[model samples]
Target: MAVKPNQTTILLILRIFQSLFAVLVLALSSFVAHWYNTTTVVSSPSQINFLIFIAIFSILSVTSLVILPRVFSNRAVANPYILLGIEIKNVLFWFAGWVALAVFLSRLLFCRGSVCHAAQADVAFAAMAWICWAGSAGIAAVGVFKGVKKSSGNNVEVPSGGVKPEAVEKEAV
Candidate 1:
């Protein structure tokens, strides 16, 4: 199926924002974790580490999805089902990562200093990143559903008389 130019442009814009938000989350979370490890006796919270992991994973996966199709121009790389699957996976992971980070931040009795502020910013960016991913997944889901509908519509059956629908319509005319 041919992709419309506008749809391609919109998806590209959404992906760019997703990448930017992921990078921002990564930077903030890393700063917070490093600050905790170097200045304080306690280790950084597990949520921060998970956020880092999600950011890294998103960056790598999104990069590959964007570049691989252009580089190889392979039909498999451009398959809508595969694209939908990856988008859905990212959506779920991003959702979990941000929620976990928010919960961890809420449990803190006092959040002060630059590190605390950075952690708060990380939560905000993580949530934004999740939104971007969800948008991508929604677009992919629509494309997949449309493709399924089109394929099914093409397979309409005739009656036992073997009269084509088009032929019946022409006879009526």
Candidate 2:
């Protein structure tokens, strides 16, 4: 049987995922920074990096997709739309920035002394980087879509066919 999640439970899940992803992103960045700084000594990072990257990149995207629309609609606290019309746009932009940051950091970590890709490097790193980048872009795009949809005030649904003026006036109260 399917069980419904309570409101606080849902927010807790979202915050947990965001926190986990943020930690992973920061940790990966530090590791990458150190790895490239000392690439001449260490051949490659352990397989654990690959696993962590995959876990983080995939999990981080859920909040961008799930939490944003609710916030816009005032289903969640701190409605971005209620306070400022531009808040949604700002959030979307930041989402893109996060993705770009992750991609740039991952590329630097793997390529280590060049802006170019290396054929000799581990293919998993390359794949993870691209997927994370593309996924992040997708997430940001979804936020943009939400911002547009909500800003236009399009959530008010019409009945299956149409509502007559008398019925609408009666329902308005």
Candidate 3:
């Protein structure tokens, strides 16, 4: 369910710009992480590689955020599945994925490179991840709900000068 190119140009541009910004953020974070990697650890896990770990996750985040969305938006793809469409559904799914990635990254940051003490957090990562994942799924799921039926059962309500469904029904009767 890809949208025509003519209709999606603006959306595509906006998405590209967003991707660029995200990648830039990851790049800056990577620089910081690399700097962190050069420092000595004072804890039991003297062999810790926190910077490398963050760098890997940053790469993964950038891939999921930028590359996946572009792939989903491209019209050349032949997948016709409604759930995987490039319309509102795909956008929502992409948005959710981005949000989840952000939450995960934030949790990583909260750990502050102390792998052994990461589990001590009370309400940062645990609750945030669930909230992000569920919210995303709900938004994309609405598209599925819309596809279930073309229209709602309610009749259209028109203004005084407009054609009225009730009057039309009376005339037909």
Most lDDT-accurate candidate: 1
* TM-score computed on alpha carbons, candidate 1: 0.78
Global local distance difference test of model 2: 0.42
lDDT: the better of candidates 1 and 3 = 1
lDDT of 1 by residue, 1-173 (tens): 98667666777898899899888989999999999899989999899999999999999878976876555544577565776788888889888988998898899899999988898899888889888888878877876675433222356542221234455587799
Question: What lDDT, from 0 to 1, does candidate 3 have?
Answer: 0.38
Measured with C-alpha atoms, the lDDT of residue 11 in candidate 2 is: 40
Q: What C-alpha lDDT, on a 0 to 100 scale, does residue 73 get in candidate 1? A: 41
> Mind giving the per-residue lDDT tens digits that candidate 3 earns over 1-173?
97655313433454444344334433443444444456644322211233223324434543453455345533433222332343333334334444444454565535554432332231133233234333433443453444533222455432212234445587799
Give residue 11's lDDT in candidate 3 (0 to 100): 32
Per-residue CA lDDT of model 2 for 27-117, tens digit only, reads 5544554564575565434332443454454444444544554444335442333322323333343344345444644665454343122
RMSD of each: 9.8, 11.6, 13.9
Itemize residue pairs with steric clashes in candidate 3: none
List the pairs of residues colliding in candidate 1: none
Q: Which portions of model 1 show Cα errors greater than 4 Å?
A: 1-5, 148-173
